[model samples]
Target: MVTGGTGVSGETAETGAGGGEALATLHRVFGYDAFRGEQEAIIEHVVAGGDALVLMPTGGGKSLCYQIPALVRPGTGVVVSPLIALMQDQVDALRALGVRAGFINSTLDFDERRTVEAEFLAGELDLLYLAPERLRVEATLDLLSRGKISLFAIDEAHCVSQWGHDFRPDYLALSLLGERWPDVPRIALTATATRATHEEITHRLNLPDARHFVASFDRPNIQYRIVPKADPRKQLLAFLRDEHAGDAGIVYCLSRNSVERTAEFLNTNGVRAVPYHAGLDGSVRADHQSRFLREEGLVVVATIAFGMGIDKPDVRFVAHLDLPKSIEGYYQETGRAGRDGLPSTAWMAYGLNDVVQQRKLIQSGEGDEAFRRRAGAHLDSMLALCETVRCRRGQLLAYFGQEPPAEGCGNCDTCLSTPETWDGTVAAQKVLSTVVRLQRERGQKFGAVQIVDILLGKRTAKVIQFDHDQLSVFGIGADLTEADWRGVIRQLLAQSLLAVEGEYGTLVLTEASGTVLRREREVPLRKEPKRPTASRSGSSGSGSGRGGKSKAPAVELPAHLVPAFEALRAWRAEQAKEQGVPAYVIFHDATLREIVTQSPATVRDLGTISGVGEKKLATYGEGVLAALHARTPPSGPAPEESPESPENPESPQSPESDWPEPPDEPGPEDWD
Candidate 1:
């Protein structure tokens, strides 16, 4: 089982000794001079054969926690991933770093699987990736038994938790791993998990003794905004044009039809977009995913089925056309944007219909009473997040059990343009009175529209047919606009004072409605603005109105360096095309930007740049130098060495080096 071979290229034979060696490996292999928060601690612990349960935010350099340990340890590290579709990209990225990584998934042909299996078994792989379902196969277990695994990494560990937003049944079988390989340390990692879900993952993964590391959940780079829905397609188009023109983004919809329609609408309106959903043909879905990953500035309008393990780093925004069922789901989806630590937006177009639709789905969903209750609780939390008048970031972090600063996170919509809260007790009474009159007096149930129409004294045919205009509550709500009445109803539902029932989504009063009707409880609601606020750039020059910090300005190449950046990008694109890999697999945009800014003349100078490890330096250094030279003027001073360039032209730090360190304690904001 321990037979040895030279192993794949970039294989490190030295066993993990201590932090010194780990740092060396980081610099030599990953080309990073420093580790981010808790990265050093996690790596050291895992390398020392300690189990860990890491709750890092997305883009928190989680892969490095297990990867460095794997490289430093003697044998190969076996990673169990749930994203079969993204396994190739994962492996490709590692391979680009000159690491001996391979993946065995359904995407591979028989011969390809066999080759990877042989490499893993022969101790020729530094890392072996397997989809969780692959473990269900006895042959996979047998093969793993024939290999020397230094450690076991369970990626996306939250999938094992049944309460998790994105649960995968196959992850339940992963607990068997600890029993089978008693000596190998195991680390489970996820980008999002609440305390309950965290406990579930620990219990389900059989890692009760594992060291738990819960990083702060704030994604400061992402400016969260929940806008009022009004012709969502047009609003989305306007947002794209106004703030994120030609930027790559994701638009998540609740249904496949919405995904397709949104994609079509974006395309028709001049934004290049593609549709992705489970309903599409397998090949079509794969093709669309591939295109989204490879092509720049192409938006993918998708259902929840997409974006689980997508590693594309330049996504500028994550817009939601429909409400996500829970904060965890919303966080996970929105976390997809700004993975590069640049300013991005988490924009959602929410309206009363979204609340009604979500409630109706829950009521009609196939679940037991307990399940429905849990789903309802989840919806309540999401609705609360949407409705909160305080800092959005604080509420979001609080949901995950982390304390945020007393002041607002000025980056969110609420912090940027705070909405006023008004006493809506009379408005609440009128709406509840209407529902009560319909149910008790007329023995009728009507959806929000009809109720609103009746309350506003509109003699629409349906209202007139039902003689609803004669009701006492009729015309009482005429003081408020139709939009204003809908906001009240939506908030009432959110507060559980109102309940949604039946396929038609008729609104009904809950037991608590009595308190509001009798004036025993006060109702405060966010007042609907006369005009919806136009979507703003999360990275714009405008500061938060409440004095909360805005996100850092977006990273832009200087005009003088733009040519060099573009040329390098063109070269990277061609290389990616020829190699049949995503462009980032060759060199990240950050690295290329640095290359343009520094204008490294020799391969040695290029080697000083972060992300330019030994293998990459050897493979692409000459090409990079050529690209820079081509863009440089022949007669004048080198632009990079010119006075306008950076003063300290020394080797640049990793792109993330400038990123603010996450607060040492639990309360401050952190970038994902």
Candidate 2:
């Protein structure tokens, strides 16, 4: 089984002999001046043959933990990844950096697999990526046994936990890595995991004594904003038109049908978009994912099945049209944005229907009582986050048992909008009184909209059929609009004073409702404003993520330096196209912005930029300098007219004429 070959590239012969050598590789290969937060410590520990459980954020340079150690240690690194896309991306990125890396997955033909296996066994590869399921095969184990492995890296280690949002049953067998390769140090990494999920990962992976490095779960570059759902399609279009026109983003919906509809809707409205879900054919899903990754300024409307280890670094936004199952899921999904360390938006629109559907999923799911209870608790915590009136970052970090900084994160919707809360005691009494009248007096159970109608005295066919106008509480709430009453109901749901029961999503009074009915407890709810609050944080200074102002964020670049930035981006886009890669692979927008600001004239000055590593500098350094030197003064943005110019086809039309009114309110059937 042992096959031999020479180094694929001359750079493969380079090795980090510890101390200064590791630092040399850090700059020369990975293109960084120094290791980020606990990276150096982790690399040192793993190189010295110690186990680690690293909990770093999405763009936190987690690969360096195992990669540096792999290069420093004596043999090839074995990485277990869950998704084939993830493996391909990492291997491609590694190969681009001049590291000898290969992957074995179903996408490869038998001969391709055999070739990679041969190279790995020949000690020609510094790192080999495999799916955890591959480790279950005896032949793969035998192959690993034949080659000396520098370390065992378990990517997305949280997948080992049954309670994790993205759990993979195949990961259960990964514990054998420690049992079989006892001498090899192992490192597990994940972007989002709670204290329980963390412990579950460590225990399930059998790394009981591994050194744990829990990086701060904060992603300061992503601005989190959750808005109340009105007309979801309109809300989304407005968000795109106002803030993220011509930017790439992921729009997560709850169902495949919605994904298709949303993508089609976006396309019809001048924005390019694609739909992705598990229901699509294999080729279709792959094609959509490929376009989403390879093309710029395209939105991908998909289900939760889309993003896991997707390496596109310039995703400008992550919009959720439905509520995620839990906070961990939300964190991971939103974390996909701003991976390039530039400002991005995490925007969502949630409503009572999202609450009902989530609860229904948990209740009818295949699980025991304890499992259901835990799932309910997780949903409750997620609901708490949605309704949080304080700093979202504080609540989010606190869920993971980390304290927020004292000043509070000024970037979230709550901090930026400063929503005002008003006493809802009387409102709660009115709503609770109506529920009591409907069930106890009239022997009728109704959902939120019907209840709103009865209270508003709309006297619809159902109200008249039930003769609900005869009741004492009927028409008492006529002063408030239907929207106002819905807000009251949502707040009550958040307060646990009201519960929706049965498969019908009927409004029901909880024990807490009795206290509110009797005036024993005071209820306060957020006053739903008629207009959306404009966002004030992040780099863009236009309207709020929910959309208000018409003008785009003013571009702040000085007129003279704009040409340099454009030239660099033009060159980067050309390189990316030539290599069939995403443009950020050459250099991110943030790096280019920094380059423009500094106006680096030489390869040495370019090397000093944050993202310009040694290999990248050597490869593109002169080309970048040439692009900068070619920049001419006073051209006004671009020569062929800005894509955002008045004549641009991608520009938004009249907002009112372009979008349909908010779709009719969700009916009871919609909840199912």
Q: Per-residue lDDT for 502 in model 1?
A: 90
What ranges in model 1 sit over 4 Å off?
Answer: 1-18, 532-554, 632-672
Using all chains and alpha carbons, the TM-scores for the candidates as numbered come to 0.89, 0.89
Candidate 1 lDDT over 294-373, as tens digits, reads 89889999888898888887788899988899998999999988766556888888888888878987887667999888
Q: Point out where model 2 deviates above 4 Å.
A: 1-19, 532-556, 632-672
Please list the C-alpha lDDT of all candidates, in the order they appear: 0.80, 0.76
What tens-digit string does per-residue lDDT give for candidate 2 at 1-672? 000001110011112233566777776776655565677778888988999999988776677788888988988999898978656656766776678899998889999999999998899999999998898899999999999899999998988888766889999998898999899999999988988888999899999989999987887767888877877777788788777877889999877767788999999998899988877888998888878777878899998889888877778899998888888999989988876655688998887777766776777667899998888888888989988788888888899888885877888888887778888899889999999988888788888888888789888998889888788888899888887888888778767788878776788888788888878999888877674554433222224433433433222254455677778878988998898766666766666666666677678888776656666778888998889878845334534545434343221111122001332233333322
- Candidate 2: residue pairs that collide: 31-613, 534-544, 535-544
Q: What is the lDDT of residue 56 in candidate 1?
A: 85
Q: Give the TM-score of candidate 2.
A: 0.89
